[model samples]
Target chain A: MKLIPYLVYLLLIAMHEVIWRDVTAIHGVTINLAAFLVLAVALYKSELTVVWFGFFAGLILAAGMPDRLGWHALALSAVAFTAFHVRERINLKSPFAKFLLMLGGLFLHNVLVVLINQSGGFLYLVWHSALTGAVYTSILTLLFFAFKDGYVTVRKIRDIF
Target chain B: MTWISRLFSRHSRNLHLVAILLLSAVLIYGNNDLNRYVNRTTLFFSWPFSQVRCSIEELSGVNAENQRLQQSLVEASLRLTELDEIRRENRRLRSILEFEPEPGYSLLPARVVKVVGDKIPVSAVVINRGQEDSVLVNQTVINQEGLVGRISEVWPGGAEVQLLTHMANRVAVRVAESQEMGVVKYIASRGMILENFPIQGNIRQGDLILSSGLGGVYPARLVVGTVASVEKPEEEAFCKVLLTPAVSFSSLQEVFILRPD
Candidate 1:
């Protein structure tokens, strides 16, 4: 059901918050569940629903982090919308293509957030985010792709029967 | 329909343009203060999970004890030394606290939930006690070993205790043996410095450092650290003194926040 997906999304976001609260990974990646969820769902569903989901996730993220209000909501929606658009242009057939696209989108998201935060020491933040995002998102993108692909295939088989 | 597919493709390209515009507008106009409020609120909501994480972390320590018994014993021995030091420091703090508690001296017991690493210039430990427990800002905290640090910020169910080693932490202390005074300055290469002590003060390498009572935030005479090295120059007006913290903050898992009576 819809509730199950939302719960799973919240759990992942909570887990990310727990692990990487005040700290960034060596390469400067901060785990972002809001972006990850948007990417996962957009790959599985339609554009409009994914956009709405991203907004909700953004709301949850923004609620907790008081430093940037609508910034995240805006960033997440943009990432979801772009991913949906790209899926149609290329053959959404290959898992590698999807993974690559996710990575690219995540990199863009990180860069855009850094620019908004206007955090000093600009060079360090950008390079660190790029390296860290690629590594973390690649691992996550693989798992989500497999899960979504399997679910869709199973649904197709069930419909035929 | 095939016609529907064509129309969708045509508009999908435009969707990217609209998304970018919206994103730029939000970034330009997003309220910074609101974002900070959201962060604070998010932190409050995440408290339950951090508590769970801390409990799990504490459990791992117990599980590690059986596998690393020898290591545990060695740690225990170190703790015993630490306990003795704590007892001596407690007596010193009590004498200082006895003289006159600045204004409101409320004591509370808080357990260390988590120690965030020091990369952020703000090294903090999450304590189980919070606003509900009447833990307030500016209250002095000390372990059995020595003076820890003051409460910088507080939450409803938990609070963050900034450790003595943090870059911004400075304590006023007196040399126990020399009775000479200086402010303890944090040094990157060295642990701490007793800067501006009179050149004539006979400060040995191992002389003890105690709070001078000048800093109202910390009750005077609490053990801060010990002199590690002294820098003396004949031409200079004051000597530079280095101190090693009395409490082994790295291994500190529990501390008692002194209730000023």
Candidate 2:
């Protein structure tokens, strides 16, 4: 497959980690774009491609924190691998099914991140940051999935007009 | 061997996952130097963006800081104005403390309670001291500056002092330098004119006019005013001398009743 696009995706993930993570955060909640992108790749790309991309995305995401790099990379790879198998087993013909999968995946990833980074306040963070972040990211994922498919199209709009 | 190759291909993904896990375990438990390098590199790239972000945050806070500073400025200005008024009052009180009344007359400090007038702002002012304070009618009222007025009416608790600015008020005064005598009276048309003074008196502009003790109403040697101008008309018998009152009548706050010893 093409390597250049994957490199660009990794760069985008790094950009999001450093710049947009805090800027786009609402209150204390933030979007887990690295996990979301990894899950998206698992939905379409091959299992090997998904796992590798997830690993690199994790590295880029946790680049600011050097001590957590290896664990984050491993965790993202595991998430990609699991999501790939789940996609293989589940019938995700509709965008709704894909949206649900994305929501679940993002929530799991957010929980993992909180567990890795936080020294205390596990249950509180799970309720506040992890849950809200998952929901916030899921809404964006749903919109993305809807646009990616022809659920609402330009041609359909022209015909309606 | 062909069976072994198929097994290897099938389990390649699992082996890769295990490898990633081991690498991550190393990063998590050890490799501080590696982590520091990675974090430093990340910060190096993100520094410019973070600077911009900090500036934006500070800019947002500027409006709140500005409003807070403005409020503080207003409070400080009001406090300063109050302090200035207090300082002026303190200076007046200091001068009043140093003031000494004429010999054989004791000074009783009194605050001006109420001022009554139509044209001149304070033609008559009621003092807090009355019969209870031993303040009697015709008693001379003076302040730190000089002669203010004399007690006109006295009640059990309060007394009204007629200021020298009043149309009915008169003070027998003399030129301090020449000792030339004149009766100073207030007229609506011509302010405090020295009357009954000879046209040939050795008086010039800016001569000090003091109470001459002739009327038996006011004491002698008390400063009343300074000679503003002396006009000796050819038709008039006496010189028409104008005087600038030494006491600032409009700002009268404190006064002393000159009671005999």
Model 2: per-residue Cα lDDT over B1-261, one tens digit each: 998889779898777777677767777777688778766765654566667667877987998899999999999999999999999999999999899888899999999988886566468998899999888899999998889999999999999999998888999988999998989877867777888999888899999999999989999999999999989899978888898988998899999998889
Chain A TM-score of prediction number 1: 0.76
Please give the CA lDDT of all the candidate structures.
0.73, 0.86
Q: Residue B162, candidate 1: how far off, in angstroms?
A: 67
Tens digit per residue, CA lDDT, model 1, A1-161: 36677756855676666756435454356666667677778787877767766755665565554545466667777788888888878778888898888887777777767766776777777787754766587677787778777844666768999
**Candidate 1 residues B1-261, lDDT tens each?**
998888779887466557555653554466666456555655654667778889988999978876799887889999999999999778756754554333655456678888877463335688888899888887778776688887878899988887787778888889999788889867666667888798988899999999997977878888998888988889999997878887777766666676666
Count clashing residue pairs per candidate.
15, 1
Worst 10 residues of 1 chain B by lDDT: B95-104
Supply the TM-score for candidate 1: 0.40
In TM-score terms, which candidate is top?
2
Q: What is the DockQ of each candidate?
A: 0.16, 0.43
State the lDDT of candidate 2 residue by residue for A1-161, as single tens digits: 89998877776776677678888999978888889899999999998899888887887777777878877887788889889988998888878789888888888888888888896699999999889999999999987887778776778779999
